[model samples]
Target: MAKKSGNAFDFGLFKRLVGYTNPYRFTFYFVGLAAVLLSIFAVARPYLLQQAIDTGFVPKNENLILEYVVLMLVVLFLEVIFQFLFIYFANWLGQEVIRDIRVKLFDHMMLFKKQYYDQSAVGRLVTRAVSDIETIASIFSEGLFMIFSDLLKMIVILGFMTYKSWQLTLIVLAILPLILYATRVFQKKMKTAFEEVRTQVSNLNSFVQERITGMKIVQLFTREETEYTNFRSINEKHKKGWVKTVWYNSIFFPIAEMSSSVTIGLIVWFGGLRAAEGDVITLGVVIAFIELSQMLFRPLRQIADKFNTLQMGMVAASRVFAILDTDARVENKGTIQLKNISGAIDFDEVRFSYLEGEEVLKGVSFSVNSGDTVAIVGATGAGKSTIINLLNRFYEIDSGTILIDDKDINTIDLKSLRSHIAVVLQDVFLFADTILNNITLNNPDITEQQVTEAAKEIKIHDFIMSLPDGYHYNVKERGAMLSSGQRQLISFLRAYVTNPEILVLDEATSSIDSHSEQLIQDATDKITEGRTSMVIAHRLATIKNADKIIVMDRGLIVEQGTHTELLEIDNGYYKNLYDVQFSTVTE
Candidate 1:
């Protein structure tokens, strides 16, 4: 329930959203013209009745009566036609504008860095892209028509009533101030109710998503009853919020209906007396005034109904604007270009913190010579992964610099910098697509031969060919259909296919079976042959053949040497880790 404060609906955002409608402005203009024309034609209908009653019917002029009826029928038909056209265009215009907004919002969301995703919730973001856009879409579709049609008809009827009988018009309009006051009060209450409902919806969505994703864990921990109770709590909150909105609407609509009925009764009674006394009121004028009063109150009923949707639109607009306003924490201002690289990497006084007042890496400095394999080993949260994040520029360093082939990383274009790095993560993420697509990651430009060669080099081609569909086999979400070993193998092939200048193997074989680990080790050796590689290994066996080993503790490099060199030290952390791994293997 974040508050939407000042300048949230500023002109800048409105202007940008409005720019989306520029393509359909001409059609909207036609809708406006039709609205005006329909309003004029509608006003003429009551006048036609008035004229026929006072002149043609009273005198028994058959030809004049028939002529007026024919004219009225034509006007009625024209009004209906133009009304349909107006609605058609307005709906068409609104939908297209909404489509444009959704596409732009999604595109912008994709361009944003991982930091933004970390800070935002999935429920709220989906609500904005979906519910909020629909709210705005309603404004363009039916809301605009009701606002224009009702307001214009009210204006025309009011003007005509004043022209025909000024004294009576004044008497009827005295209750208008009361109508406006009631509308304002109901609108304020309804807005608050709808806002509460929107919050409840987001909460419900979050609970459902969290529970479904972690359902297996809930069952394993015997927390089914607890989770059910929690889910019921969220559901009850949503139901209660909905009931409150219904209660308010139930009361408001009846009040509007009663007030309108009272107004109509007063107009009819007063006008009847005036006509009987032979004053300015005539039979025809009296009838027309009654019709005019109904027209005026019709819009009032509509205005009441539309208040709910208008408030919903405002809330949605606030959400959408918030996302569009997110500032990028990672910026690429570098103009340097490097088409060919030598795979050398250096970290010069690099320091970083995920948040303020808590530093993760302090004065971390290291260099990997061209085509060298370096292992970074430490206990959990020693800033091991943070070092690779800096190398890939996923997150910015708080201070100091990382360099690639002598060029400061911040001085190179970000896309090009990342393009030269290949990352094989331990947690594999495969799309629900063909095995070929999963290996190539839907990158159409990657040739089939390149995919096959990468798979063969990674020692997975033979295994894939044994499967029913081979490369055409479908991988479920997160590679759920494949074994952990198979998923890891595919990830290895994916990484090697890029043939990157630098390789980041982030505990890449941590979860694989022994057989798959050996295959990955072979693939790793081939891929890292001419590339500078940084290995973050929890398994000592994986990095035993590294050219250099750096042992870290509390954000500092406590020891650095070859594995054999580190093993020779009697009390070093690396020696202790190697001894522990050896003990486990022997046991």
Candidate 2:
């Protein structure tokens, strides 16, 4: 959380938001100029009315009345033009600022280390990126400059009122402190209300987004009623939050209107008493004070509302800057760019832990020679997949070293290091796009012909052609339009098309049907023939022919040998595991 500079608004945060306008300073000046002109025109209307009534009526001069009326009309016309300019330019400036902010935020998130994503919710980030920034835009269009214009008009009207009749002006002034106090109370109350409203918005967005993404789970488990009740509970809190703000507005606006009416009545009564007593408070002055009172007090009420807008905008700004200020990105200080890699990997006593003090890879050591197919098998939570993650530098290690082609992996450019390795995980993900787009991922250099050739190499081109639109078929979100087996095939083709120097399949075939499993095995064999490969599989039969098999149990490599050699051990770990799996299949 950002430190607040004050109770209601943060001065530091407001200044930071204002700094976004540095790029749009020309629009800032235009809005400022409009506010000044609008304030003068607003005061001139009532002032001209008072002058025309008193001076023009004294001589009964029709020409004088016509001239003042024309002047008032001209002033109204210019006010309208500048009002349009003010609103248009202010909103334009706000949109441009958010555009740049959104881009900067996205680019920052792109480089964030995997742990940040593992800890944060996707929907909450979406709310910060989309709706919250929208609230900040209101700071310009309906907020700060609008509030400035209203406050300026109030000051100018008070000056004219005092000059015209000190006696009547005193009556209006008598009510000023009460309304101003009420406004301050209302603003403080609204500050807390807006905070609740923003918090509820994020919760609601996160809940709905998660439920939609997991709708399959909800339906499969027959928990629709339970989840619906949960949604209603969250939704009720959101409604109550908004209702609290509305309830405050209800009390504040009526009190403001009543105060304005009382001020106008006091002006009329006082001015009449002075005129009867033969004092200098004339009827024209009395009428003008009513106009001035309306002009002044209405803005006072609106200022309270705009202050609420400014408050809400500040709350949103704090959330956005929190993400921008995060030091969650991996430091890429290496200058070495990989020209080519020989695909030999060495992990010398590497140590890693996803959580503090709970090591997943505990001083583990291993190696994979060039063009060798090495398979790693382990029970769940035995660190089989941690090796793959550490290889790509997804999570930094706490100790020891990982080398690719005898060069410390950390000494290679982050992008270049990952570019030479391809991973196909158990849970395949596809975007809501055509198969071709998902395959190339909009990489300009990955031509359609190259993807087709890669698909043929994997023998999935025939299956892809059987789809409705072949490679042009839309997979929908997360490949919902296709079966689980087919999604795995696309993932295989995706990895193959990259032509990586090293391939890692972390149980990629574990969730597929037997037919898809056979297809994947064939593709895997062809792709790993000359390229270095690492396979983490639960199905020991699939890796029976591997050149070397590393058996892991509780974060330690307990056995390392080929299939026939491992089975030759007296009650070896691989023999026991292989016997249990095949026996389970027999049962």
How high is the CA lDDT of each candidate model? Answer: 0.80, 0.88
Candidate 2 lDDT tens digits, 1-587: 43443377678888888999999899999999999999999988887787787778756778888888999999999999999999999889889988888888889998898999999988889999999899989999889999999998898888878888888888999999989999988888888888888888999998999999899999999999999999999999999999999999999899899999999888888887886686787666777788889999989999999999988888888999999999898888766888767899998998899999999988899899998889999789999999998899888999999999999988988999999999989999999999999988989989989999999988899989999999999999899998888898898888888889999989987898867877777787777778899999776555786889999998989999998998899999988988887446521
Q: Against the correct fold, how does model 1 do in TM-score?
A: 0.93
Q: The CA-based lDDT of model 2 is what?
A: 0.88
- TM-score, every prediction: 0.93, 0.96
Candidate 1 ranges beyond 4 A from true positions = 1-19, 277-279
RMSD of 1: 2.7
Over 448-492, each residue of candidate 1 has an lDDT whose tens digit, in order, gives 899998788767799888887999998777677888888888888
Worst 10-residue lDDT window for candidate 2 reads 1-10
Pairs clashing in candidate 1? none
lDDT of 2 at 182: 90
